[model samples]
Every structure is written in C-alpha cells, then in structure tokens.
Target: MSVLVEVCIDSIESLPIAEKAGAGRIELCSSLATGGLTASAGYMKQAARISGIPVYGIIRPREGDFLYNSDDVEIMLADIHTAKQAGLNGVVIGALKADGRIDETVVADMVKAASGMGMTFHRAIDHCSAPFDALEFLMSHGVERVLTSGLAKRADEGIGTLKEMVAFTQGRLSIMPGAGVSPDNAKRIIEQTGVTEIHLSGKTVRNSLMSYRNEKATMGSGDSDFAITVTNPETIAQTIAAIRA
Candidate 1:
C-alpha cells in the first residue's frame, strides 16, 4: 500500500483543501503558530461534520513543555471527551514526566478515556530520556501510533533514529516521522525511515487582507504578525506524489 499523508490543519478552511489535495487523514489543531494546540470545540465539530477522511483532534491542553500537571491531565481528559462528543475519529495526545519519561499514569488515563477511538502519542516521545522505552510503554498502553522527529529538530535530520524506531516497533505500533517535512524530501524521509504515515502542515503565508497598515502593534511574537498561515493544496498534493513515487 502507498504511504498515507496526514495533513495537520489549524482551521476549517484548510479541511477541504487538504481532502481535495488527497490527504489520507487530518490532524486537527489550533494555533499552528505555536506547534499546534487543542482545536476549539466548534472547529472539531465542524471538521467532523465536513471531513470525508479520518479526523484526529489534538488533545494538548496548553503550550510549553510536555511535562503536564494534574490540572493539565484533567484538561486533557476533558478535551478528549469533547473530541469524542464532537464526532471526531480519534485524538492525539502526549505527556511526560520531569525526568523525561512517559507519564504512564496520565497516559493510561487518557487511553482508557479514549476507548474505541484511535490514539496517537504525539512528539512528546522525542522529549523522553529513552525514546525506545517510551515507545514500548506507549505500545503496551495500546496507543496505535506515534508522531515524532526521532528526538531531533527535524525528521530528515534524524533518519537514523527514525529507522531504528521503525525496526524496533516490528508492527506492534506505527511510527510516523513529522516536523519540517516537505515535498522535496518527503520521499527520502519515507524511504529511509520506513514510515507508513507522514504528517505536515503544508502551510504558506497569506498576508492579511486589511489594507490599513498597523505598524505599531504586533499581536504575535514573530515578525509576520500580519500574515496568515493556511494549508497549500499544491504542496500537499506534491508531497503525496513524492511519497508514492
């Protein structure tokens, strides 16, 4: 079978674009600017209503490190419940201990709460002290897949670790390489890592339509405060083709 392309989208407007571009799955989120956080309830419901492919809502409760507190766990569980109620097919989750290990108790609670729904342990594994051990822990906990950059800044930069992760899984779980994936290197990453699934936003900047120039105030941290990020159909399609080639 050909590799599956999972487009990570931050808005409902990008949903149809990703689907029409031949995305096999969607990782729904908000604030892609901040590496994606939990998508709003309204967004989740609308995506589930309109999307033809599987939609997995991200369950991250906040930004910053994956080391979550009890309160964060509470919020995550509630978000997972919201995703299910919104009719999403699955939820993506990740949490870690201060020691850079998987938070087994919290993860187990999440897995139990997400019963009957697909679960992807997000790149939090990359933050672990032992990624392989973390993978085994997640597999034992019944997570279906993992999204990671192999503990590096980008997937392509970590091909060796990615290869080892794929070999280690042995079909007990799925390892997906994400982060800085592009059409130019999509085929190389897949061929080198043996991953069956890949994730990317395929986003491009669209300057705000507002003609008024607000030079003084900036709403966000970066220099592109006036620019909007949206999924590019051509980029997604090209990535699919590259992987399938």
Candidate 2:
C-alpha cells in the first residue's frame, strides 16, 4: 500500500507547487502561523480552480481553543457551505466541549452541512480527553479521515498511542499522523505507527519584495512585516521521497 501525503498550504500559490511535488491531498487554510484559521472565500475559490489534487479547506473561525459557542458553529457551517460551493473536495473540521469532549451537536451539524464532501477531523482530536472514544464518535459520524498526533504534542513522540489508534480502527477509516512531521522523521513515523497517511507543512520563510519599508508602523505582532510563510516544494518532495524510500 502507498502512503498518502497531505500538504497543508496557506496560500493559492503553494497549491500547484505541492501538487507538482506529488502531494496526494491539500489542506487549504489562512494564517497558518497561528495554527491555521479559515481561508477566505476568494482564496478557497482560487485554490479550487487551479489545484489538480483534492483540496480540503479548514473551517476554523478563530485561533483559540477548539471549544466554540453557537456563533462559531454558525460561522463554521457557513464556511463549510462556502467550501462546497467553491468546488473544494472536502473540509477539515472539529469542535469540542468545555470539558474536552467532542461536541456532538456542533460536529453533527458540520457533518450534515458538508453532506456531499469528504470530511476530516482535524488535529483537535489531540485535545480530547478520551481519544479512543472520540475516534469512535468521529467514525460513527461518517468522518472519512482524521488528522491526529496521537494526543501528543508531536507525532514522533506519540508513536505508542498512534499505533494503538491504527490498530483500533482496523482499517475502518484513515488514521493520519500530523504535527511536527518533517522529511527526517516522516519515514520513521510511518514505519513505527503503521499509518498509511501523513500530514505536514514544509513551511519556509520568504522575504517580501518591497523596496521601501515603514519600520515605524506594524500591521501585526511578531518579526519583520516583510517575511511571509510559504510552503517549500523541495521539502515536500523530500518528505514524500523519505516515506517511499
């Protein structure tokens, strides 16, 4: 069996680059610096129009915890509808309750809203209190795949739990290991966890092309405003090669 590589890209420019690099799927989003928020409608449409591979738009509305209110559910549902209309192949979504359990109601609504499209429960599963139980819930709700780090900070460090998840699923759905995955560790993660699918963002910094700079004013927090985070096709290619090798 072949391993599936899903590259998480924050911009449309990276879509073709990842596809050309042999990524099996694309998880499109914005503000990946802050763990990825929802992509703009225009960005989603542009990505869907040009990408050759499957594109799954992130449906998150904000950067904080996965626990959401009613308004957040409405926003996520609207985003799911937007993704479906934008020609995206699927949506990446997850929501939890205040006590760290899967929010059944909100997730059900999201699954229903994304009726015809593929659905992937994002890394939010790492935050769940009962991961195995949560996996059962997601599987029962018709979630086609799950992007998790085995309830740890990084996939490599969570190999034991990841192994258990793959075994528990029994091939019912995809158990993809994501978070802190790199070319150096990609092959090891697959070999140890028995997960056929993996997720990564081979991200690198790109300097902006502006001759003039207004250092006195800043648009957002963090380093120079001239730097932008973009996907590195070479890194993606290298990671794919490592897994296949």
Candidate 3:
C-alpha cells in the first residue's frame, strides 16, 4: 500500500499547494511556530471550501502543555463544533491530565462532539507517561489515528519507540510519525517504523513583498524579520515521492 502523507499547514494559501503536491490530507492550524494552535473559523471554512484533499482541523485552543483546564476543554469542544459546521473532514484533538495520562473524560466529550467526523488524537501523546498504554486507551475509545513522534523531540531520534508503538498497535489504530520529517529521511523513518502515514510541515521561508522595510517595529516577538515560513510545494512533493518509492 502507498504511504499516506499529511501536511500540517497554517494558512489557506498552503492548502492548494499541499493538495497539488499529492498530500493525502491536511492538518489545518494557526501559529504553527508555537506548535499549532486552533485555526480560526474563517480560515477553516475557507480551507474546507478550496482544499481538494481531506482537511482535519486541529482542536488545540492554545500553545504550551496539553494539560488543560475546564475552560480550555469547553473551548476545544466549541472549536470541534465550528469545524463540523465549516464542512471539515475531521478534527485532531489532544488533552491530558496533570499526572501525565490521557484525560479520558474530556477526550470522550471531544470525540462525542466530533460525532460525524474523523477523529485523530494529536501528538500530545508524546507528552504522556505511558505511550503504549495510551495507545490502547485511544484505540478503545474509537480514535481513528494518533500522531506521535515516539516521545522524542524529533521523529528520526524516536524511531526505536515508534517501531515499538507500531508493533504494539498491530493495525488496531494508525500511528503517524511526525515532527522534523524531511524528504531525506521520510523513507527511512517509514521503512524502519512500519508506519504507513507521515506528517510534515513542508515549509520554507519566503521573504515579504513590501519594498519599504520597517526595522523598528515587530508583529511578533524579536526583530521584524520580513521573511515568513510557508509550506513549499516542492518539499511536500519530494517527501511524498520519497515515501512512495
């Protein structure tokens, strides 16, 4: 079977790029620099309208730890509703307790909210204390897939654990290795881990169009670097080809 490639994109512009590059699906989000918070309703709706491939809306309410409070849970539930209404194909969600385990109750609620859409447990699984146990929990709860980097900072570094996770699951659930996935290593990671799906940002820096430079002010933290990172179609195509080969 051909490996599935899912590109993580933060804007509507990248949607068509990913689709054209042969990505089987997209994990739509905002602020990918901060590990991808939830995308706005407007952005989600636009992506749904234009994307040729399936778009799974990321349900993260904010950046930082996956451990969330009641308010955050409520916000995530609302986001799932918005995604469904916007005609998205699915939703990616993650939540954990203070003790480093799956927050079953909250996850159940999120799953229920996504009744008619595909449900993915996001990479927050990397933050859990027991990944194998968590995999069983998610599978039992009816989650369709889990995006994980094998509890390591980068997927290449975590190939050992990823292989183990894939073996343990045995096709009960889909295990997608993500984080730092590049064209050079995409094939190796898949060959070694036995995962049929991979996730990547496929991003490159593009300089701003403004001729007049403003060095004094900045929209985000640090200096006003006129260049912004956006998904590169060539990179996505290369990664997909690597996996296909």
Candidate 4:
C-alpha cells in the first residue's frame, strides 16, 4: 500500500505542483501563513475544476483559536454544507472548549453536518485536554482522520507519543502527522509510527521586497503582496521517494 502524501495548497498556482509531484491528496486553504483559513466556494470550485483528486477544506472561520463562538460554529456549518456542492471531497474542522477539552456538543453537530462528506479533525486535536480521549471520541464520531503535529510544535518532538497514538489507533483511524514533515525525515517518521499518511507543504516563501508607497492600504503595513509560499516540487518528489524507500 502507498503512504498518502497530503499536500497543503495555498493557491491555484500551487495546485499543479502538488498534482505533478505525485501527491495522493490535498488540503486546500487560503493564507496558510495565517495557520490556514477556509477557502471560498469560488476558489474551491476552481480547484476542483482543475484537479481530479480530493481537496479537503480547512473549515476555520479565522485564525488564532481552536475554539469557536456560536456564530463561528454556524459559519463552519454553512461552509461544510456548501463545500461538497462546490466539488470538494471533504471538510476539516476542530473546535474545543476553553477548558482544553473537545467541545463534544459542538463537534457532534459538526459531525452530523459533514455526514456525507469525508471528515477530518484538524490540528485542534493538539490542544485537547486528553489526547487518547479526544482521539477515541473522533473515532467513535467517524472522523476519517486527524491532522496533527502530535500536539507538539513539530512531529519530531511528538514522534514518541505519535507512536503510542498509532498503536492505540491500530487501523481504526488515520493518524496523519503534519507540520514539519519534510524530504529528509519523512521516512524516519513512517518507520517510527508506521502511519499510512503524511501531510506536507514542501513549500518556500516568495514575497516581493518592493515596498508599496500606499501605506494606508497595506495589510502588512506597506508590504506589496499578501505574501505567497510555493510548494517545492523537488521536496515533494524526495518525500515520496523516501516513503517508498
């Protein structure tokens, strides 16, 4: 069986690189520099129009919090409701309580909302009070996968526990380790965790050095563009090669 390399695409431009580099799946979002936010239906449709592979939506209303307010929850519901219609293959979401626990009630509603589509628990699982508890809950909730750094800043730091989680999960759930997986260590993580899927950006930042004179309209306080990061095609090929090796 092949280990799926899930590439996170930040723009229409990056999608072709991901498709060409032998990635099995993609998580499409806007402004991944801001830890990712939901891509619009128009963007989602455009992506779906281009590639035949599955594109999972990052169903976050905004950056900064894994927990959502009532209105934000409604927004997530709406996003999920329309995502498949926009031709997306799945929806990614996570919401937590202030007490560092899975917001069970909210998550349950989300699960129901995303019933027909593929569902993944986003890295919000990283902030959960108890890892196994939250994991089992997601499994029971029928979440297809959990995209995480194993509750750590990077997968290397969480490798030990990620192994434990993989053992606990057996084959019931997909434990996808993301954030910092690269060509060099991608093989090591798989050898260690024996997981079937890994997520990657294989990306490098590309921003204009030229400053804009219109300081009043600059989102970055005079920066020219919204700051773009492109997927490294060589990194993608190298990561898959390592996984196969």
Cα lDDT of model 2 by residue, 120-205, tens digit = 99988999987788889888988988899888899999999999999998888789999999999999999998899999999988
For model 4, give the 10-residue run with minimal summed lDDT: 213-222
Q: lDDT of all predictions, in order shown? A: 0.92, 0.92, 0.91, 0.87
For every model shown, the clashing-pair count is: 0, 0, 0, 0
lDDT of 4 by residue, 1-245 (tens): 57999999888888888989998898999988788899988899998888868889889999897878999999999998878788888999899999889998999998998888899898998888887898999999999999988888998678987888899988889999998999888889888988889998898767646665554465663354545678878899999998888
lDDT of 1 by residue, 103-208 (tens): 8889999999999999999989888998888899988988989999988999999899999999999988999999999999989998888889999999987888
Predicted structure 4: clash tally: 0
- Judge candidate 1 at residue 136 and give its lDDT: 91
Clash pairs of candidate 1? none
What is residue 241's positional error in candidate 3, in angstroms? 1.9
Report how far residue 245 has shifted in candidate 2, in Å.
Answer: 1.2
lDDT of 2 at 226: 86
